[model samples]
Target: MRYHTVIAWAAAAGLLAGAAGRGYLAPLLPPDEGHGAWYASRAAGISAYLFLWLSLAGGLLMSSAWFDGLVNRARLLAAHQAFAIAGLALGLVHALVLIPDGWTDFGPADLFIPFASYYERADAALGTIALYLFAIVTFSFWFRGAIGPATWRWVHRASFVAYLAALWHGIRIGTDTGALPVAVLYLLTSSLLIGALTVRLVYVRPRRQAPARPPSRAAAEPAG
Candidate 1:
C-alpha cells in the first residue's frame, strides 16, 4: 500500500511538471510561428486519449474472467486504478495546455464548463463532460464502500459513457486525426474498446442456480 501511494504521488508530480514545462517553459523560447503551442497541444491531447484508452482496456481486462490464469486479479485491479488516475491527469494537461496555446479563445469557462466555447461547441462540450465524468468515476473508488456495491457499479458504468464522449470529441476536434498514423491509432483503440465490451457482455457467466428446498414438515407428515 505504501508503495502504491508513492507511485501515485510520483505520477501526480510528473504530470504537473510535464504540464507546466510544456505549457509555460517551452513557450519562453523563440516561437515557431505558433507551431510550438499547436504541436504541444496536439501531442498532449493525443497522449491523453492514448492513456484513456489504456485505462479503459485495463479495466475491461480486470473485470473479465478471461485473464484468470495469466494474471492475478488483484494486481490487474491495481494497475487498472493506476492507469485510470494517470489518464485523468493526462486529460487535465490536454485541456489546460490549450489555454496557453492561444490558438483558441478557450477561457476557463470554456475548458471547465460544457458548451461554453463557441469553437466547435458540441464537440468541445463532449470533451468537457467527459472530463467531469472521468473525475467522478475515479473518485468513486474511494467512496465505493459508502456508495454500496450496486451504486458503485452503476457509477463505474459512467466510465463507458465518458470514454464514448471523449472518443467522439477527439474524432471531431482533433487535428492529428487527419494523419494516417493517428487515424490508425484511433481506429485500433476504438476497435479494442468495442471488442472488449462485446466479450464482457456476451461471455459473462450465468448466475448459479439456487438449491431446491426440502419438503415441509406438514407435507411430509401428510404423506406419511
Candidate 2:
C-alpha cells in the first residue's frame, strides 16, 4: 500500500491495457475509411496534453502551502505520478497511431526522431522532444533515491520545458485547435498552470541564515 508500490501497479496495468488494446481491440473497432488513424492520433494527443496538465498542476499544488489543510499531499503526489504515467503512455500512443495514417506517411523515425518528419517538421520535433522529456521526468520518480533528492527535483523542473514544447506543438500542428472548444481548453489549462506556478514562486521563502553568535568574552579579551 506504499506510494511506490501503487505507482508500480498502475504502470503495469497501463502497459497491459495498452498491449490488449493494440493486440485485440484495435482490429475489432470499426474503421473510419482512411482517416481512422489520424482521428485516433489526434484524440490521443489531446488526451495526453490534458493529463500532463493535470500532473503539472498537481505537482504545483503539492509544493505550495495554499492547499495545506484543504488537500492531502500524499494523495496529491500519487495522483500526480499516475497522471504523468498516463500522459506518457497516451503521448506514445499519439505518436505511434500516426504510423498507420497513409496521409501523414509517418514511419518510426518520423515519429521518434526530432525533425525527421517533413510535415511541419519543427512542430513535430517539438512534440518528439517533449515526449522524451516527459518520459525522463516520469521515470525519475522511481530513481529519486538513486539520483538524490536535489537531482530529482531539478529533473522534475524540466517538466515545465516539456510542457511548453507540447503546447507549442499542439498549437502549430493539431487540426483540432481550429475548433473553438479545443482552443479554449488549451488557453484555459495553460493559464491555470501559469497562475499556479506564479503563486508557488511568490510564496516560497528563502532559507534564513542563523544569526551570528556574539564574540566570546575570552576571545575578545585575548585579542590584545
Candidate 3:
C-alpha cells in the first residue's frame, strides 16, 4: 500500500476510535467530573491529529522519495507547514473546548509550567511544550523574510521534542485506557513512529553530512 494510504487510514481510525471511545464513556463519566474528561477528549483528538501531522511531516520531509519525486525542497517544506498548521488549528480547538472545564489556572506561565499537575500536570506540561515548539517552527511561515533559514531550521529541529513529549503525555494519563487497548496502541503506533523518526534523525540523516574522516592513525601508522 502507498505510504499515504496507511497514514490516512491510521489517522482516520485513531480519530474515529477516540471519539467513539469517549462518547461511550460520556454517560459513565460524570457530567461534572473533574477536568479529566476534557483531557481525554483532547488526547484522543490530538492523537488522531498527531498521526496526521506526522504523516504530513514524514511525507513532506521524504517527499523527495515519492510523490513529486524530490523536485521541490522548498515546496515540501511548505507542505509540511500546511499540514502542521492544520493540526495546530485542531489542537487549539481541543484546548478551547477543554478550557471552560475550569481546570488549572490559565496564564502565560501555565503554558510552560511543568511538574505542577496533581493529576496529569506533568503530561499536560509536555503537551504545552509541544504546542509552543510547533508555534515557533511555524512562525517562520508567517515571517519568512525576517526569520532567516538558520534560526528557522533550529526551530524546526525542536519538533521531535514536541512529538515525543506529546506521545508520552497522552497514554500515561487518561482513564479511558483502563481496558481500552491503550497499551497496545501506545507501543505499536505511537512509540514506533517516535522511534523511527528518532532513528532517522540520529543515524540516517547525519551519516550523509558527516565530514570525511581522515585515514585512521592505525592505518597511517602501518598497522604495526
Candidate 4:
C-alpha cells in the first residue's frame, strides 16, 4: 500500500512538472502574450495521450495468454496497474492545465461536463466522457470486494469504451494529428489494441465437460 501511494505521488509530481515545464501554467516572468499556459496545455494533452496508450497496451498485454510464459504474470499485472494510475494522473493534469490557459481558458465545468466548452464542444465531450469512464474502471479495484468480481469485471470492460472515446478525442482535437508521425502512432496503437483483443477472444480455450458416468451394477443386474 505504501509502495503504491509513493508511486502515485511520484507520478502526479512528474506529470505536473512536465505539464508546467512545457507551458501549462502562467509564466513567472512577463511574456509578450503570456502563452505559457497554452503551450503547457498542448504538451500535457499529448503527454496524457501517450500515457493512456501505455496503460492500454499494458492492460492488453496482461490479458494476453501468449505472455503467460514469456513474462511473470504478477509483475505484468503490477506494471499494468501502475500504467493505468499514471495515465489517469496525467490525463487529469492535461484537463486541469487548460483551466489556467488564458488563450483557451476552460473552467471546471468545461473540463468535466460534456458539451460545456464553447470551442470544440464535441471533442471536449468525448474526452470528458472518456475520463469519467477511465476513473470508474481504474478506481473499481479498490471496491472490487464490495462490488463483487462479476460486477467489477463488467465495469473493467468499460475501459474499451474509454479507449475509443479517447482515440476519437485525440483525432478530433489533437494539434499534432496532421503530422505523419503522430498519425502513424495513433494507427499503430489502435491496430495493436484491436489485434490483442482479437487474439484474447479467439485463442482462449473452451471448457471441457465432465465425462458421463456408467450405469450402476444393480440396475444392470435387474435388467438381466
TM-scores for every candidate against the unseen true structure? 0.78, 0.78, 0.56, 0.77
Alpha-carbon runs more than 4 Å astray in model 2: 1-33, 204-224
Model 4: lDDT equals 0.75
Q: Candidate 1: global Cα-lDDT?
A: 0.77
Clashes of 1: 0
List the candidates ranked by lDDT, beginning with the highest.
Answer: 2, 1, 4, 3
lDDT of 1 by residue, 19-95 (tens): 86578756543456765666666666666677767777878877777787789777666666666677677778777
Q: What lDDT is reached at residue 145 by model 2?
A: 92
Residue 171's lDDT within candidate 3 is: 59
Q: Which sections of candidate 4 miss by over 4 Å?
A: 1-34, 205-224
* Highest lDDT model number: 2
The models' CA-based lDDT, in order, is: 0.77, 0.84, 0.56, 0.75
The TM-score of candidate 4 is 0.77
lDDT of 4 by residue, 1-224 (tens): 34575376547646664765447333432363677665555556666666666666767766756687789776666656666776677788788877877777689998888999887999989998988898898778879999999999899889899989998998999776887766887898889888888877777644569898888988668553
Q: In every candidate, how many clashes are there?
A: 0, 0, 2, 2
TM-score of 2: 0.78
Better of 1 and 3 by TM-score: 1
